[model samples]
Target: MSSKPSRCVVLFTLLAVAGCTSSPGKDFFTETIDSLHAKTSPLRAGYSGPAAVTSASNAAQRFNGAQYQGTGQFVSSGAPVTKVTGDGSGKFELNLVNAPIADAAKAVLGDALHLNYIVDPRVQGTVTLQTSQPVSQDALVDILQSALAVNAAGITSRGGTYQIVPLSEIMASTPPVSVPSTSPSGPGVKVQVLQLQFIAADEMKTILEPITRQGSVLRVDSTRNIITVAGSDSDLNAIREAVSVFDVDWMRGMSVALHPLKTSKPEAVAAELDSIFGTKEGPGAKLIQFIPNDRLNSVLVITSRPAYLARAATWINKLDRLAETNESQLFVYQIQNRPAKELASVLSSVLGTTVKTEGQSGGSNVSPDQTPIAMQSDGVTPAPLTGPSPSLPQQDNEAPAHATVVADVENNALLIQTTARDYQRIEQILTKVDVLPTQVMLEAVIAEVTLNDDLKYGLRWFFENGGTKVSVTDVAKAAAAATLPGFNWSYATDNIQVTLSALSKITDVNVISAPTIMALNNQKAILQVGDQVPILTQQSQDTGNGSAPIINSVQMKDTGVILTVTPRINNAGRVMLDIQQEVSNVTKTDSSDIDSPTIQQRKIQTRVLVNDGESLALGGLIQQNNSVDRSQVPILGDIPIFGNAFKQKNDTIRRTELIIFIRPHVVRDINEAREVTDEFRGKISLQTPIQKRRGGTKLQQDLKRLAY
Candidate 1:
């Protein structure tokens, strides 16, 4: 052999050895195909042939990790690769004649590339391509995708393998609920399972499906009564806790029965229950229902939880206790101020209860013969009493009355028996009656005024009717006569020293003037009188004569009094008045002159308690008497004394008296006060009598006017 041929042969042998080592054999390809086919084997039954074909292509691409760049043969009859070309422009040429897609991919990519087929077992399609052009792996994928579009085919790579799937299936699958985690769970983090009993499979899916994205798996079985969850410790714990609320049917409820007490009515109890657990406003109507029994003797409470039923039962018990308290007790009232009969009348009218008076006449009782016997249940009439029937029992017919008042008129007491609730109402009514109209007490003073004869005639007081002033020209003769001892010149000088004391029933102060109306609630009066009086005091002064009287200082005398009165009203609508009265008087005594005149004062005071409209009269005061004398001569003395001849002697006596009156009225309200004051407000004015027209008779006027 030649050396050149031997070198070429050795080089060829090295290249063949490199090719055999670098490129996989048919067995490697077969193994790759088997792996891909196994991965996509499940999809073949569910997907079309084209879909399986696309999956197999993806499987090969994923395993090889290389993209097809040039012409690739698919489904042609010839060697796996008839032509191959490579250039730096990313361009290649290859011929695949009558070969499957797997071989075509291997030829196009490189001699070292391996192709795996994962097509459907039933598929008959093949790849045949002869081209010289620059093409990308994606372009080849696009061509395959177009062919598989009719069958709704898709591909997915996982675990270094491609799986075939229908396009519709790919589109229909939902995105993961949560993103998968890249880092592994820490130590002590273990997968846990949560089982749901009451929740439906679909609902559990919706609630826990989100954990799938966080590397958790939720396995639900509709046929089973439980749901299984697998996840990390923390995630599984969270899901288990959240799903517990939904594990039990909260809509399912329990029922409680109740019996009505004696004091409580079924309808009333039902109303209260409704208020607490409303049909529409509280906790969803379907969760609570109040169903009354047919006889209304019991009530059924339907509630979602036992707690609700317990709360309702507590309220019902409280209401029943209150009602029972009101019904079981008795009330009694002892009235001291009001008369028994009157109180009984008030009780009957206000409370609508019958009242009985002690020592009252009894009604006639029916004889046993007149009374009919009740028939027995066996249709036999009961026999009458054998002996004469005693007088009917005192309380025989009182059973039907709610209350009975035993009125003792003599002792003025009322013993009552009634319910406690009724007593409250009775008390209120009594308060109003106690404030009925009250009367006022009245007190008055009457006095007779009299003047001493010494002052009346000796002083020769002048009157307004006619002045009687004596001339002093005759004073000298009178003075000479008065100077004689034991001469009777003064008229009754003993009476001048006498002082008439006033009766002890006069008051100087007055409160609440007469003709005033006051309410019965407030009835008290205060009176005060502060009157000023001038008095002349006798004083010794230096005069011409020793110890002679002269004008001295003038003094003021306090002749005023004060009175206060308070009235007590009784239940009889009458008033008892407590009165205190005082009076002061200053009287002037006869003296030599005005400056030497003596003054004396008298005070009258009294206290009396009397009934309404009662009168208090005061008397025994000073009196005054005056007389005038006149004389006339007969006609024979008609000369200078003729003026007195026509007159006859005559004496006239005059008397004067003082009297005071007081009256009071008690009113209940403003309207009553107004009516008392306006009692005579309405008056008819006096009118002139109408005169009748007499110019014509009735017949004459009728005849004249009747002319057509």
Candidate 2:
């Protein structure tokens, strides 16, 4: 009876202990909390806080070479919705459907519950907006919707496909802008490039960065009318040098309308306009300066007349959807101006579509109106899509044009994605006038927009279509991104390094820098994770033989990169990966040497994960156990007086990080200490008895040292 009772009590005690056990999860949680609080991690991972967005005060913010505040909503096809004039707030939930844009939105936003802010300053007063510390996708969408409601207009997509609200419409309802009574001196060295190729804010930062740091160069106004000149004569020269690289003609000598800022500072717009226009290089004086009286450009008159070509130029914006294919939007400036009849005939003859003379279809309404041919097209009628104005105000007249001047005059611009091959075939039919070119020209602007790892949207002379690519049949082999889990391998034209982002917030990654890793030319990749993605990596070869690299693949690893990738194509792409790590080891003072605590040598290990993309954008960078952090090198711990010096003959490994690229060929880094330690342990085990050697292993030793 006593033995039975004892056994029962022991079993009950064992069960209770197991039920209330605290395992590695809790242990790790406690350890991590204590270590992080104590500044424990040798290489404290770098992280960025959520980005805050607000309207530009006077500095005037520009996006992609266009003046923009935030996204807009589509108004009714032909309905006068309510407009808000005073300071107001509301929401605009972007509805998604079976479309690529929807997929992109999901891929970017994920399931985050809130978004920060999307301020659209349509009113005269300033916009009040800031970023929340814990930003959520819901918050981002909410902010976007709130901006859309500035005008408080009801939006109704024609077919619920896709639509963007017009900034003009929202601003039109805004109260007049109130100018301050007291004005500064002359034009305060502020200028806005009225026209330029699409560029990012970061690029502008790169251009303007040099002057921002100098103490001698003071900004007259942080809001607007920024003047950047050296306080001293000598410093002025240095400022000029720093800005030189950014002054290259991005438009390749195309007419760029530059408006000197209107200010009371030293220089004034009115004072400069006359002298500038008088000069041969001035926008108004130069024949290259493109201005429109009709706010449109006719592509049909390129060879004959090169004047204000806003309407024709507007067509180029239709190619924005092709960015994924590694090609940029097409830009075709006018070389000559031709007769409207001639322009109409050329497009009608080439694209196999009929040209009309009136705004209404199949109508022959004629009037004695002789507005020089303004709009041009490739005879392709765009679908009824809603978006922002495709062309800029190159023309003086802000008045709307009669539809007859355009070939495909629709309310909104319709961008279609296509392939280079099909584009080649279409080019064969058009650029040659009667027939497409048998051989592509060396300088031809062959536009290719990448949609994903596979598939490209391109210009088929005048048609837009989605290009197909090599699909992955085998589901077994795929690449896993730390940022993107559902990532598969897709072949692309150029490597695109995508950091999983939501509402403009990068959710993960230690640090993100432009061109973080290194690879041979043409090394970039793409990845999509979870239900938001259609396929992981899709691949297609570039048809052009321009010799310049067409595709590359670069990917960020989740854990110390250790994944492998196999390109599905033959030889059309390349991939590579790079990693830099810093490691440190600390030791306390020995009893014999009480004066100074001896520190071990800190180690820096750079582990680069190499890949081969073979010219396609679809590839992956895998890291083996050979991982190294950027700061894994030697360092003295933050000591009071005698700190930072590595102890002689002592080794310290602090932290490690990894970077990977996929394409052509890649080199990897492996550590020898692990191997040597294993070898040393094996020798010790052979010498000592089994009981004494017990469970000591090199892997165990390395891990133990890694723990505090």
Candidate 3:
């Protein structure tokens, strides 16, 4: 009895210690031990009563197990409608239908976790869920928030309480947090600050606004080039995608460019474009700056993005067009490769106005009633005038009916005051007219041919048989017969040198003159190869005061080969030549008048067309001479019969022909012109003396160096 009492006292002391350390809530350790005891009671039923009792007593004493089995399940008869029940672990069971979202959130967070919450007035929704298996505490909270999101309401944690608000107002309620990465945090609405790398934040806001949710908020920090967005995860994803596409390296740089205006003034165009696409000085400012250069007629554009620059350029191009109204504008056009006075005259005619040069007596005049002559579709001839008289003066304040052109000789430009439409027409005409004129090189060879019996017809027949296409006009043939058979003939051949070489072998060819000259299109070139002889035209007898006989007048006559040629080159590489050739010489001296001589001349005047690099031959000037020669021995020819033998008499007849060959080459560029010069120089070098040739070579070398 004493031992039993000691054990009881020890056991009572241990129980008091255990009760002192136990938690105030339901005891999980005692409940779990009772559940084990009830489960194993059936397994120990088959043993004898005392043995079982003894085994159970020993187990209870060693392992601290309970003696009696206890119920393993707890049951509640009438629970609250929105009460939360869960196992001791993190798992919980939920079975609620059409429960208020606020109460459901309270049951999960407030009741289960002992946390605080406040629902906004706009947060109104219901949640219905029935789960057979228990969910973890975190999953239950997630489900509650999902149900709230479906009704356009969201919950965010602030301080220690869960604040529930309308989805539209979630961003306003939550404090913004910076997210370095582009991806979103999670679902529902959250405020995230994003720092942009390339694109302007304001521009990105515009791009994201359309795709953003109804309750989302987008703000820009221009100074920092960042964007703060409050949106759902999907909305943030869309913003990220758009930012990725637009905010690239190609869109980052700022560029400046000058765009020259073609018809309109730079100031007017720049002003118009600025009004259309210009923006203020901030993020996404497109037309940062526009500077109009009146001297250059160009607009300078400054922009921060290439795309905006392209857009601005497009608008500028559209606005920089000629104004259709009759508003006068002043424009200066610099004449290139043409005389300003000449260009002004042409433009004046096109504008139906009379423009006078510097020294002229007329003020600038425009016709009020007249319309400018429209150019034909072929761009050459002017259409017939269809309007009223062109002499009508313009009113004081009204725009000039016809454009006025003033030639600025010092600047070599034309100052035109006209309507934009008229100016456009004038500019087109200037573009076509004020250009370098085409040049032609004319080469001529004048030769005198002593005709043999076989060549009595003329040199034309000789050239025709030598594979040359020769044609002569009927008028040329008639003129040839009137003046010792002088005529003009044109022939086409590939090589003029080959023809000349072949002609030299046939007869005694004496080249009187060979000249190569360059002339502008439709200009005249003259070549004279001989002397000017003075003829006594008038004479007076000696005066009564014993003065020598006064010569009243003397005339100069061109003797020998004289040629005047005018070449007109066409676009098809063909030249039309108007040629006047004359070969004149003193045939005899008058015995009665020593000072006067007989002059024989053959002239041919005609026009012929020949291909470029081809030759034109003028011939049919034939002259015949008959002479008698007598020879006798000095002394032995005294006897009558012997005199006949000693004396010799001969009769001779000489026939000669004059031939002129003219070849034209159209020089289109500097290289062709240089080639012609070199060819001419080569010909000169052949005829020059050795010393002169050396000097010419040195001069050519210097010219070559200068050209280079």
Candidate 4:
């Protein structure tokens, strides 16, 4: 029994410990106290503090999650026949229907609600509504909302009361309210009266009234030009902002007129305007629709912002100025052989502006009120009296018939329009394009190849029958006597000699100088005469001294010929040609010891002027080719053994002549060029056709017999 009692005591102790463990301690309680103190301290010091609560009191400011600033009844579609009643708890109710919505609502809810209703005497429709069973107040309100027009009336409750009235009546009867001038916050409805001097009061009312709700009242006094509005501070501030955009002197209606210089049709101008301003979509919380004007090219800027009108005016004025300049000055020109489309492109490229063209449409050709003439039959031509005719009457300051004219391009002509000052410049450019190209005649003769006089096998036989070795010195001495002064030597030889008399010997090779020729269509061009003419080489002594060994230096010389010419055209389409020619004979000498090349040149030059289709001949260019051959006499020449007997030598010389011919023709027009081409074609045709078969003529048969 004692043991059982001890077990019971242990169980009791465990229960106590468990209970103690489950409960909070003094530290946790102290923390809670500290937090309470921190949160309450501000409230005790007379500040509202953060919106929270330890207890609810009339003086304590607390915020509930589901709450609103003011009390209000709800309505939709300009009616409140269905009541909207709600408590702080989430419960609501609705009542009677089948009557004027605003009147029934006012009777049930009283003045607590703000109602805005405008009575249209012309409107006679009645709203009928019924419910089969009880429903939430929201359902009843929704039913009423579906039956009435929102623009006519509405119901709103504030300050713990409900009211209903016509939208227009409420807007007019509500007391003026105030809103903070700078801050758009705080409690209560605020009213503001703004007197607009520039914007019409009616217009401001139209813009503001539609956007305000039942809680907001907007009134306009046309005579005083003032706007009176009342609403929640936020709603009132919004209305004020909207008014600010259009409350300006320019907003009344700004118009700008532009008269383009070219008098474009109204439709065309309208298209241009549409291209610029474009479409925009609004008024008060809605899109401003853009409507295009079909009657005029002018755009009606139906916007409340002045800047848009100003910007559009600036663009239109700029376009107008351009049109003015385009029309103020005019020029017309006729060009042949150029199409209108092609000419327009050329003008656009050259002038950097748009150019338009029309198909060869002939312009006006009316004679100004001409006198009547009697008709004559029989196709008889009237004969003029063989005497001076009387002078006709002349009108004062009247321009001649030819003075004023329009474009006519039926004869393959281009009609051009430009400023008066640019007319001459454009004319010159067209003339250059249309004028016939100048024909240049050229004549040339390529003379013989450069001379190479060295031995074919580097061995020179002095005599054919010597049959014995000859010293190179003796052979060099003999060749030196016959060598021309300008001939080059391959091997350097001591005691070399050249005869001055050889230089004076006139060869068949013609020498010439470049021509100083000039030609001009209108003005003379810079001449290149005598610029590249070859110069004759002067004689010089060798720089090497007679010593142990000597090195010969090489020299450079100019070779070949140059010719220059110019043609001048006269009024009669005749070309006078000036010509110059230069001829050169050059020789180059090189030795193994020389570091640089040697050259020498001899020149003959001449100049003359000739007419078109004339020929100039230069006859003095002649070249020579020389060669020597050796053979044994008959059988002795062919025998390998003792074959050196009776050797013989033969020398040969060949000469060539070079000549040049030139001709030129001046063409004035397309017809002239075509005629020349046709004549040449006729000649070709004559040589192409086969003739009828026949026996050969006497001259042809004789030539054939000689060939056989």
* Winner by TM-score: 3
What tens-digit string does per-residue lDDT give for candidate 2 at 216-245? 333333334233332111223344454455
lDDT of 1 at 65: 21
Q: Ten-residue segment with the worst summed lDDT in candidate 3?
A: 692-701
> Candidate 1 lDDT, tens digit per residue, 21-60?
5545544334434444454435445554444334543534
Alpha-carbon TM-score of each model against the true structure: 0.26, 0.12, 0.40, 0.29
Where model 4 places Cα greater than 4 Å from the true spot, the runs are 1-154, 157-206, 209-434, 440-566, 572-574, 578-607, 632-635, 638-648, 682-708
Q: Candidate 4 lDDT, tens digit per residue, 506-553?
A: 222221221222233332333222223232343344456544444334
Higher-TM-score candidate of 1 and 4: 4
After best superposition, candidate 4 residue 560: deviation in angstroms?
12
lDDT of 3 by residue, 512-587 (tens): 6666778777768888878888777888877675766665578888898788888898878888888888888886
The candidate maximizing lDDT is 3
| 1 or 3, greater by lDDT | 3
lDDT of each: 0.42, 0.28, 0.65, 0.40
RMSD of 4: 33.6
Candidate 1: list runs displaced more than 4 Å: 1-433, 437-524, 529-560, 566-576, 584-617, 620-660, 666-670, 678-708
Considering lDDT, where higher is better, how would the candidates rank from best to worst? 3, 1, 4, 2
All models, RMSD in angstroms: 28.4, 59.0, 21.2, 33.6
**Candidate order (TM-score):** 3, 4, 1, 2
